[model samples]
Every structure is written in C-alpha cells, then in structure tokens.
Target: MAEIKTLAATVRSGTGKGAARSVRREGNIPGVIYGGGEAPTPITLNYREINKLIYAGHFLTTIFELDIDGKKERAIPRDYQLDVVRDTPMHVDFLRLKAGSRIKVAVPVHFLNQDVAPGIKRGGTVNIVLHAVDMLVPADNIPEAITIDLSTLDFNDTVHIKSIELAPNCTPVDKSNFTIVTIAPPPGGAAEAKRAPGKLCSAQAAESRHMLSS
Candidate 1:
C-alpha cells in the first residue's frame, strides 16, 4: 500500500497571479484541492517542505493527509507546475480522496527472483520496457508497486501485461496487452553456452572410458 504522509497547509486568503506571486514572495507555494464532491479550496504550503517532497520521487502517486487549519483532508497529488527556468515548484493541484473512490496512478514496477531466472543464469540481460504502469485502484489501498516474477523466464522470453497477476481491485489503465520485459540473449549467445557444456561433458566421459579400457 502507498504510504500516507501528513502535510501542514493553511487557507490562502487570495487567488490570482498576483496572489500566487505574493505567496512565493512569502516563501510559500500556492495550491488547490478539488474533487471528491467538495468545493475547491485554495491553500498554501511551505515552499521548502513542498520542494523537498517533489524531489523525493513518486510525489504524484503518494497520498497526503493535508492539515488545513486543524482540519484533515485526504488527497493525492494530481499535478504540479515548475518554473521552466529555475525548475522550482510554482503551483500544485491535489485530488481529494473519498471512501471507496478509485484513482489512476502510475505505480512503479519491481522485479523479483532475478538470480533464479534461467535467462539470468545464462548471462542474459533483463530489458525493462516499462518502469511504471498506470493502474486504477482503490484510494485507500493504493499499491506501492507492480511486481513481476522472473523465476520462470528464459533466454529470449518475454513478459507481457496479461501474464502478470495484479493486486485485488487493481486494474491496469492500458487495455491492450503490452510487452513489459524481455530476457535478451548475451552478445556471444546464451543458446550456444547452454548447448556446449553437455557436449563437452560427453566427450570427456568417452575419453575417460577409452583410457580405462586400454
């Protein structure tokens, strides 16, 4: 499940380009909370705190409990704007979370059992096509990542979206079955290595038997 974090914010008294600029001058980032059937609430967050959160990664998918003047609101960050030149946060938008609500988020992809994979043992490389996948899941049960097991994969084998078992109530946003990962053969060729060892062993055994008979 996605980890929930608490953030402190306060109601913004004004709204507009001028107001936003004033908020920035005061070392705060202007933001809004909308959706979940409630009226949009303009709020201000500490610039330094928000900047840190944005750079920490997975800001969009992370759930936040915003303490707005002693009132707690559950939300997920929907979008944020950064200054093109400075790359500093300019504004942020959040979507409120209600009971039984579902939202689309890009969940990170994780791989398991790489060491046990036949492809990996044969010196094959794992080529990841999607680092993250969009999923629609319950707001209260958002998954941290979509896991793919590579234990059964072999050289040149592919893992498609349809083959994976997702968490309950989690559905991928993409309707089409797409390739997620591939086990690519090594440059010298994994197939050749797989075949050569058996042949070499057989030849060694034959030579040993001939020497013993002689």
Candidate 2:
C-alpha cells in the first residue's frame, strides 16, 4: 500500500483563471477536491511543498490526508496540470475516498533474477511489453508493484498476465491474458534489430495488442 501523507491547504475565496493566477502570485498552487458525495472544494497549497511532492514520483497514486482550514479529508490525486515551458504545477484535482472504495491505478512492473536467466546468459534480450499494468484495488490495499520472476525463462520464452500472482483482492483492469515480456533470441536469429535483440519491435507489440482484442 502506498503511504498516506498529510498536506495542509487553505480554502480559496473564488474560482476561475483570475483567481488561480492570484493564488500563484501568492506562492501557492490552486487545487480542488471532489467526489465521495460532496461538492467540489476549492483550495490552495504551498507552491514549494507541492512542487517537491510532484517531482518525488508516485504523487498520483499516493493517498493524502488534506487539511483544509483545519478540516481534514482523505483523498487521492486524480489529475494535475503542469506548465508547458516552466514545468511547474498549475492545478491539481483530488478525488475523495470512501471506505472500501476501489480505484483503478497503473502499478509498475518489476522483474527479478535477470542475471541468472538462461536466455539472458545465452545473449537473449529482455523485451518488455508492459511497463505497468492497470488494476482495480482497494483504496488502502494497493501494492507497490507487480513482480515477475525471470529465472526459469529461456530464449523465446514469454511471460503472460495470467502467470502472475497478484496481491489479494487486486484485479487487472484487462480481462484477457496478454504477454508481459519476451526473451528474444540473440542476433542472427529471426526478427533481428540494430538495437538489443530482446528490444521489442513494432510487430511484437502489435501482436500483444491483438491478443487483448481477441
């Protein structure tokens, strides 16, 4: 489960671009909280504090306990907008969370035992098909990542979604079994590329997508 952090915010007096600009001038980021059967609440957060959180990674998936003028609410980040040129945060949106609520998130994938894989030792390339898998999980029970063991894999071996063991109660958003990664045969074999042999080609990626649709 992702860590829950406490952030302090103050209620904003009004809405619109003018109001947002005013908040920025005051060294704060404008934000809003909605959902969980409540009206949207406009707020502002310290620019520097929010900036660090955004760059620290996992800002979207990490739950937060927001302190709004002394009132607190539990929520997860739904979206955030950043400046195109400056890359500074412009606005953020939070979705209120209710007990037992399940939300869809893209959990990162991790591979294990790559050094000992027979295919890798034989010069096979590791072709990653999916960097992350979207899953529906309990608001408080989200796993940090999905781990796949590659120790037993050999050349031309493929890992599929159905072969993975997901955390309890975590369900993949996609129902069909799909390839996650493949151990591509070394150079001089079929489907060769100038890049690493295991590096995925467009054709392999297209085939995976086809499996999802089929």
lDDT of 2 by residue, 1-214 (tens): 7788999999998999999999999889999999988899999999999999999998888889999999989988989999999999999999888888898988889999988988887778899999999999898777888999999998889999999999999999999999999998887663342357567678988999999999
RMSD in angstroms, all models?
A: 4.8, 11.7
Off by over 4 Å in 2: 190-214
Looking at model 2, the pairs that clash are none
What is the per-residue lDDT of model 1 for residues 1-214, given as tens digits with 9 covering 90 to 100? 8999999999998999999999999999999999999899999999999999999999998999999999999999999999999999999999999989999999999999988998888889899999999999998889989899999999889998899888889999999999999999889797565775546566788998999999
Q: Write down the lDDT that model 1 would get.
A: 0.93
Candidate 1 lDDT at 82 equals 100
Candidate 1 residue-wise lDDT at 49: 92
Can you give the TM-score per candidate against the true fold?
A: 0.86, 0.84
Error (Å) of candidate 2 at residue 42 is 1.0
Superposition error at 166 for model 2 (Å):
0.9
